[model samples]
Target: MNDQQNLMIKVVLDNWYSSVKRSDAIFNSLTDEQLLQEAAPGRNRGAYLMGHLTAVHDAMLPLLGLGESLHPELLEPYVKNADSKTDNHTPQQLRQFWSEVNEAVASKFNALTTDEWLQKHTSVSAEDFAKEPHRNRLNVLLSRFGHLEYHRGQVAFLKEKTD
Candidate 1:
């Protein structure tokens, strides 16, 4: 990759790191009971949002060709079903899972070269990737960044309900 491309990758990674840090802060601020409570009366609980983010991030491992997910059991409850329909984990378990998955992902991400980031993700067939080079590993990170921020906002609002 050229210097410009390397710089762009660094910028995106930095932003993603910052967002994850902010999310951790928001999540740590809430009590376990607070996490079980909904941010709004009829909305998903804070615990569900946390678990959902964890499961989604875990899935990205295989999607990005990093490795298999460490928490495959999370897929059915957290990803396949709505929060209302799925069984929620304890806040402690969710917190541990969240930390473990993100740490594993970050380690994998840090080891990747700029060229690797630009390589086609595992989900794309070679023919499709050749036609659409934009469907790369870095693009997955970008999309997941947006996903994390969206749920982070919802979880952050839980602080208000607790107060």
Candidate 2:
């Protein structure tokens, strides 16, 4: 990639990181009690949403060629599975997972070369990706960043209940 391309990629990553910081602020502001409470009258608890976000981010590890997911256990309860009374993890544990997963992802993301950003993701084959080049590492990051923002908004709604 040229200087211009690298700068563009940097800007996108920066924007995504800014949203992650915003989500972190939201996570930090919630007490354990608040995390177990609903954002609205009838929705998933804050704790569930937090775990869901962590699980989704963890799934992106392999998607970006950044190695395996750090928390596959989170997949069922928080990803493939929906919110229910059965979620066994505590708010504290989910918060820890959230921080560690995001930190690891950021580290790997930062370590990528310009060429790596254009490479096919882990799940996509070179032949398939050649035909559909949009399925690249940078695109994966962009998609997940949007996912982060949507859940961040959901988590933010919990403050309304408190206020």
Candidate 3:
């Protein structure tokens, strides 16, 4: 990796961490009652969004060649089904899951080299990645960052209920 490439990777990773930090702040601020409340009428509850984001981030471990998912069970409830169709664990349990999954993923992320981030993630075939190199691990991280931010906004809305 050249200096420019390394710099670019640092910038992206910095932004990724910033997004995570913001979400973390919002999640930490919410009370259990607030989390169980819907962010908006007819929309998902804060607890559902928390679980969904954690499940998605958990899946990223294997996708990024980091490790197996820490919470595969979560995928069935949080990702494969709608919020209304699924029953969530208590807010405390969901918070534990979020912290565990994110810490594990973050450790794996910190261990990767700049070149590793540019390499193709596990989902893509070598031939396809060769044709479209942009489908790399860093790209996946960027997409997931955006996904986190979207749901974080929904969860943040629940703070109004508390106040």
Off by over 4 Å in 1: 85-87, 161-163
lDDT of 3 by residue, 28-56 (tens): 88888888888899899888898999999
Error of 2 at 104 (Å): 0.7
| Predicted structure 2, TM vs. truth | 0.94
**Each prediction's Cα lDDT score?**
0.91, 0.87, 0.89
Q: Write the per-residue lDDT of candidate 2 for residues 1-163, one digit (tens) a residue.
A: 7999899889999999999999999889888888898877888899989989899899988777789999899988987876885547988899899999999998998999888888888888889988999999888889988998988888898664543
TM-score of each: 0.95, 0.94, 0.95
Error of 1 at 145 (Å): 0.4
- Backbone clashes, each candidate: 0, 0, 0
Clashing pairs in 3: none
State in Å the error of residue 9, model 3.
0.9
- Report residue 95 deviation for candidate 3 (angstroms): 0.4
Which of the two candidates, 1 or 2, achieves a greater lDDT against the reference? Answer: 1
Task: Give the least accurate 10-residue stretch of model 3, judged by summed lDDT.
Answer: 154-163
